[model samples]
Target: MARIQIDLPEHFGFSTAIPVYLSHINYSGHVDNALLLTLVTEARVRYFQSLGYTEMDVEGVGIILADAAVQYKSEAFHGEIMDISMTATDFNKYGCDLLWRMRDQVSGREVARGKSGIVFFDYGTHRIAPVPPAFRQLFE
Candidate 1:
């Protein structure tokens, strides 16, 4: 079977640290695959916050995740801090891709690589909107 491949940028515009708690572990004693998305979601929020925007208000328009993909590289155990880095790429009229990489902060071992396709949406209008200039500027 073919696997997902995420090509990360050479430099990340944002990074955040997340510690794996016991709750994040699976029956196999490592972080569950599903929880990796959760961690990336948290990193995405911090990425926006670093740019002074929220998920619901990124330069006046909210973001709706259009799609997501994750490629696991290594196992992460509970009680370890993961360093997640992200950047915006593959921009379009109304959306862009947020690519991410995660590694163990202590061991420098890669845990996962992923990307989320996000579209700007106007909640009141209930329609897709153009990418806000301010939001795009940060990625430039």
Candidate 2:
């Protein structure tokens, strides 16, 4: 598995934290695997909101996840706060990729690392299109 370190600056963007609860626990009494995806996904939602990118704006040439992968390196216990740092990288004509690093807020240990490919879509025309200048402008 490949891993990379992402430096988060105060003004770069926003960060969201999600707490793991007993409901997210599995039979093993640890954070469930699917729970990790759920937490990371919530972080992505906040990331989009932070960018001021609404679903209406992405209606036609919106973004879609091309690929998503995560590797669990540590276990998060119930009631542990997970800080998910999201940043936009590799922005281009099509879309931008988001890199995320999730760690236990208190211990400061990395629990998982993940990446997702977001693609520009032309939902109206049923074709793939380049990201709109406005959406691209948010990062610039």
Candidate 3:
């Protein structure tokens, strides 16, 4: 069997702390696999907001999640604050990979690492849009 490996960057451009709630836990007493993605989604929103953009509008175009991958390193329990850090890399014609890592805020133990594929879209034209130059410049 093979496992998914996520190579994180040395430095992250954005980070936010999100606490695990009871609802985020599963029957086994750890953060649910699905909800982990939710935590990442929250961090993603804040990342965009920090840049003064929203998921629906980034440099005059919207963004969509093309794909995602997660590699869990440890379990996260309720009430524990998770520090998620993120950065954009692996740019293409219409999208780029948003890489992230999650760690326990107190112990600094890594919980998970992953990347989400984001694609720019034009709502009016109903087609994939080119990565906005202004948006690309921010990370370059």
Candidate 4:
């Protein structure tokens, strides 16, 4: 696996969440991976919104996921408060990358880490395009 270490931004924000009844123990008695993705997705959308960006229409330049990677370091159980801290740390010609680190609110242990590759699209031409200069200007 190609691992990327993300340096989180100070302004990066988190979304509040509480485990649901449906998000109960799996047969193995742990939060399922599918639920984890759902939870992460919710927080990610909020992150983009905080940055004045989104999965679409990122400052008039549309972008979609080109690739994604996720790693599960630990498990979360029902009734847990999972604080998902997220940020947009990097971008390139082909796409931008969003990094996420989720942890237990009480224990301060990492529950998961993830990175997503976001590629720009020319909504008019219907073709992939380079990330906008403005988006690039937001990062290191």
Candidate 5:
């Protein structure tokens, strides 16, 4: 069997802190695998908002999460503040990869790292759209 490995970027352009709620913890007394994605989703939204955009509107085009890959590092517990950092990379014609890293705020222990593959879409035509040049330039 092989393990899924995610190579994080050297620097992230955005960062935010989110605390783990009791509901985020599983019976195992650690953050649930599924909930980790929820945390990163929040970070993703903030990342876009910081750039004056949203998941549904990036330079007049909506973004659809094409795929996601997460690599958990350490167990995170309830009440722990997770510091999440993100950046955009791997540009293609229609989309780019959003990479992120999560760590415990107090302990500074890495909790997870991953990337979300995003694709630009046009709601009016219900079709894939080319990446907006202005949006691509922001990360480049």
Candidate 6:
């Protein structure tokens, strides 16, 4: 079987720092694979907040993560600060891809690279919505 390969962008539109806690460590003493998803989730929320939006209120529609893929590079240990960078790409009528890269802040070693496919959703109607123009403008 082929492993998932994520080619991260050279530049990211947003970045934030998050500290790895003991809870994030697995039995092997490094950050767990599952926990990296949570880290990216946090970063994604923060990225939206910085764009003057929230998970439930971006450009008059919420967002639903359609899918995700991650490629692990190095182990991240507890007490280490992870630098996460994010950007949007692969736009369609109703969705786009949010690319992310996580690295050890101090050593500058890449920890993981991933992308989440996000689609605009109308929670009230329980259906997919078109990508908001204002939201697209942020990257334009």
- Candidate topping lDDT: 3
Instruction: For each candidate in the order shown, give its overall lDDT on alpha carbons.
Output: 0.92, 0.77, 0.97, 0.74, 0.95, 0.95
Instruction: Give the alpha carbon lDDT tens digit for every residue of 32-68 in model 1.
Output: 9998788899999999999888999987889999999
RMSD of each: 0.8, 3.0, 0.7, 3.1, 0.7, 0.7
lDDT of 5 at 140: 70
Clashing pairs in 4: none
lDDT of 6 by residue, 10-117 (tens): 899999999999999999999999998999999999999999999999978999999999999999999999999999999999999999999999999999999999
lDDT of 4 by residue, 46-140 (tens): 77777787767776778777777788889887777788877665666768777777788888877888887778897888899887777777665
> Residue 111 lDDT in model 3?
97
Tell me model 3's lDDT, rounded to 2 decimals.
Answer: 0.97
lDDT of 2 by residue, 1-140 (tens): 65655443344365788999888899988899887888888888888877766533553456778887677788888999999988777787787777888889999998887777788887777677888877777677
Those runs of model 2 whose alpha carbons end farther than 4 Å from true positions after fitting are 1-12
Task: For candidate 5, write residues 1-140 as lDDT tens digits.
Answer: 88889998888999999999998999999999999999999999999999999989988999999999999999999999999999999999999999999999999999999989999999989999999999999987
**Residue 126 C-alpha lDDT in model 3:** 84
Give candidate 6's error at residue 102 in angstroms.
Answer: 0.2
- Superposed Cα RMSD, model 1: 0.8
- Each candidate structure's TM-score, on Cα atoms with residue i matched to residue i, is 0.97, 0.81, 0.98, 0.78, 0.97, 0.97
